[model samples]
Target chain A: MAMIETFGLTKRFGSLTAVDDLTTRIDGEIFGLLGPNGSGKTTTVKMLTTLLTPTAGDAHICGYSVREHPRDVREHISYVPQDMAVDPKLTGRENVVFFGKLYGIPRPRDAAEEALARMGLLERADDLVRTYSGGMRRRLELAQALVHDPSVLFLDEPTIGLDVAGRRKIWEHIIGLKERGMTVFVTTHYMDEADHACDRVGIIDRGKVIVTETPGMLKASVCRDIVLIRSDDRFKGTFPEGVTFLGRTGNELRFEVEDGDEAVLVLSRLFAENGMDIRSVSVRKPTLDDVFLSLVGEQDEQTAFDLTRFRTMLRRR
Target chain B: MIRTLWYVERDLRRWLRGRINLLSALIMPAAWLIFVGMALPIRFTDNYLDFITPGILVLTMLGAALQGGSLLMFDKILGFLQKFLAMPSPRESILYGKILFITLRGMIQTTVILVFAIILGAQFLDPVLLAQIYLILFIFGILLSSITTTVALTLEDHDTYAAFNAMIAMPLFFTSSALMPYDQMPSWLAVLARLNPVSYAIDAIRDLQAGIFPAMTLAGLLIGAFVVLLISVIIFRRATV
Candidate 1:
């Protein structure tokens, strides 16, 4: 049976459709919902974690319906929110024990200690969380979530603000959990993290899943190489059949081709025949960013400004 | 019920760790009992200490209850409320836990003020009367904390909640029978005191101290607490993070 399944899950915030018809399944693997800001990644996680009731359709975690049997679903899953969730006043051990008791674990103390040890926080478990570093607090949140030994875990931007090392350490624990046969559902805007950590990824945009596949498969399905050409003019002439025009901004044009070297040569000849001066040209292998851009389109200028303004308003609030 | 207790336990653990908060909570009420009770020189009562002790006790509980709302505010601000709501426990547990913690904390703080008043030469009552006094304070705690916690939940931020607290805390205490009896006040103030819930508990405690049961007033306070708590639970269950 699938560990997590959603059947046309939808959530509407008044006129805004935050998550629309989100249908997917994960079975004992780290599945990532990758999207840009306002793409409904966090909203989808919220619905599956039973935090927000879906306006239409339903989701099931471990065969328990989120709409009908929310408590059963809650019992099977744990969530780590994007914001800091640890109680700064309590010690690390106390935080874990508190979550354990909330989950009605029989031996909360033993379970809390073990979970703390697994997160490498046992040595400093007695220290107040306020005294711990940012990385330690994130790890402590993981320990608290694991105290119940849930079958599925949902992490929403788990390492959002962490430094490079902190992010790497969190991924290590996440991968470790996956190896032990736990189904992990994660949502992140960091394409690199999704490419490196996710066993399978679903690229969501504007509350819809664009594609779901393994990272390698997704890369292979998209163009292999991307050629970026900076020209002196916005040339109007179309060149050849093998080159696919991805996008254009100002004097720079982006294209997708099967082979980088061959495409560069073809493009140089075409540019000379068209009388357009090429300032510079570069060829690089396609990463997930290229796949995401091709699938979701470049973020329009107005939408990008609105996203920043929205984030600023949230921070002020 | 167990889940509710766990919520209470979590709040209690955090409360106990803040030693400065614990000590500071008693300071203002103690000052009222000592300075205002002794130095006011009011002609209505020969022993002002005995007369104002109940007021001080109720005031102490009032302060605790009002500040208790901030516990939920902090949880909301710090993102713990989101985590707690996502847990397996019923949402009512969070409400009950907060109400229980605020009431319990109020009871503890009132106990200290009661002891301090007695040590400073306020008249002492029998064990039965004392138990009734605690009972009245407990009901009052539930009433005020329910209102404050609900208000806290609806407000957008801590600063707004803090402003709301400041606007109500002093007015509720001063306009009630806490500082002076209703008869000693002007006609308008007397009318407001008669209608204030804070005065209901204080008057009942005074009646109990005077060897009367005050059955009607106690029943009224009980009904008020129950109704307010019911409303709070409804609001809480419908609350979304």
Candidate 2:
């Protein structure tokens, strides 16, 4: 059974379609929503979390429709919104206990302490949250969500504002939640973060899921095998006819072609014929972002971003 | 229930522990008691403290009500209400916690005022009458808090709440019999007092202090309070997004 499902879940803020005709299911260990800001990521999570009602369509959280069974849907779900959710006045432990009570858990104090320990906040449990750093509060937010042992956890930008190490620690805790049998539905801005954390990712834009697949499958679909070619900042100079230039980063040239399976052999022959010493070569599959951009027409591109202004062009019913 | 109680307890600790909020809460009320009482030359029928004791006790609730909208604003700003809403319990638990805290604080403040009054030589009415007075005060506290909670839930900022205070509370305290005896006021003012919820609260409290049972006054006070609470709940449910 699908742990979470949304059928045409639509939300409109005035004329802007924040989430439009979004149908998705999270049955995997971890599911992700990858998109740029104002791409309806937060709006989707807010709707699923019951913070806002859908303008149209419906969502089923743990088989309970968000529109009709909000309480039941909420019963099986835990949500950690992108914003600062912990109270500044309360201690880290106190915040956990309060949320635990909300989650209908037994022995809230102990549950709070255990969650705090899991989130690596045991040392700062007694300290007020206002005294903690940003990363610490984010961890506490995650801890509170897990206090009730919810089956499905919705994390919106779990590590968006964190430093590198903080983001790493959060990822470890996220993996920990999955190991404990919880289905994780998360959204993030960083392409690499989604590629790493999500077992399967769905790239969302203009309130719709452009594509959904395992990171590997997504990369494999675009670049069947990986061919690492070294070129200096020129797309036109590519020697291979079938090889299509994806882009360039510094001195490295990236490509997506029909023959990704025999990438190494094809690259060696090309380099050998040219009598050139390769600076550095990498034959790896495409990243999810590559497939994401392919399907969604480059979600991060300025042209795609400028489409947000069209939100105001919408007329009210 | 415990979750809601925990929030109520947390808010109470924060309010009582924070030096600035506490100091202002205490000093402002004490200053008003001294400044207004002294400036107006109002005295108790028997002892000055006795006559003003009920007013001062209710004043704590009034003062607290003025700032009550602040918690909702803080919840909205801090994003703590998100956690509370995500919890499986009825959402009313959030509002319930705030109301419970206000109710408890009202009693505690009244108790403190009575203690301080006694120390300063204010005698109690009959012990039985004291219970009636406290009951009247409790009902009034609920009404005052319900109205304030609705405003806080509806208003987006502390500035709006402050504006509401200026627009409503100032005029309310001025027109009510909080500072003067209703019987001694002008006829037009007396008519306003008879209809004012604050006046019913004050009248009910003063009547208890005056050693009168005043069954009808208690009934009127309760009905007024019930109406306010009903309106508050309706406003709260409607105002939230």
Say which candidate scores most in lDDT. 1
Q: Which consecutive 10 residues in model 2 chain B have the weakest lDDT in total?
A: B37-46
True contacts kept of each: 0.67, 0.57
Off by over 4 Å in 1: A226-283, A300-317
Please write out the lDDT profile of model 2 over residues A1-317, one tens digit for every residue.
Answer: 79888888998876678899998788748888887667888778878888778999998888888899888988888888777777777789888887777677778899998889989999989998889988898999888888887889999888977899999889888988898888999988787888888899888877777888888788877755556667543433345677766767677767666667666567656766666566666667677767767777644445544444553321110
- Interface root-mean-square deviation, each candidate: 3.8, 4.7
Q: Estimate each model's TM-score.
A: 0.88, 0.86
Per-residue lDDT tens digits for candidate 2, residues B147-188, read 788777766568878888878776676677777777778999
| Candidate 1, B1-241: lDDT as tens digits | 9989989888888888888998887677788888988899799978889889988899888888889997887776778887887888887888889988999998988888888988988766488988999888888888889989998987768889899999988898889998888778999999999988888888998998899998999899889999999999887766653
A217: Cα error in model 1, Å:
1.9
Q: What is the C-alpha RMSD of each candidate to the true structure, in Å?
A: 5.4, 4.6
Off by over 4 Å in 2: A12-16, A220-274, A277-317, B1-3, B38-46, B186-188
The CAPRI-style docking tier of model 2 reads acceptable
> Which residue pairs show backbone clashes in model 1?
none
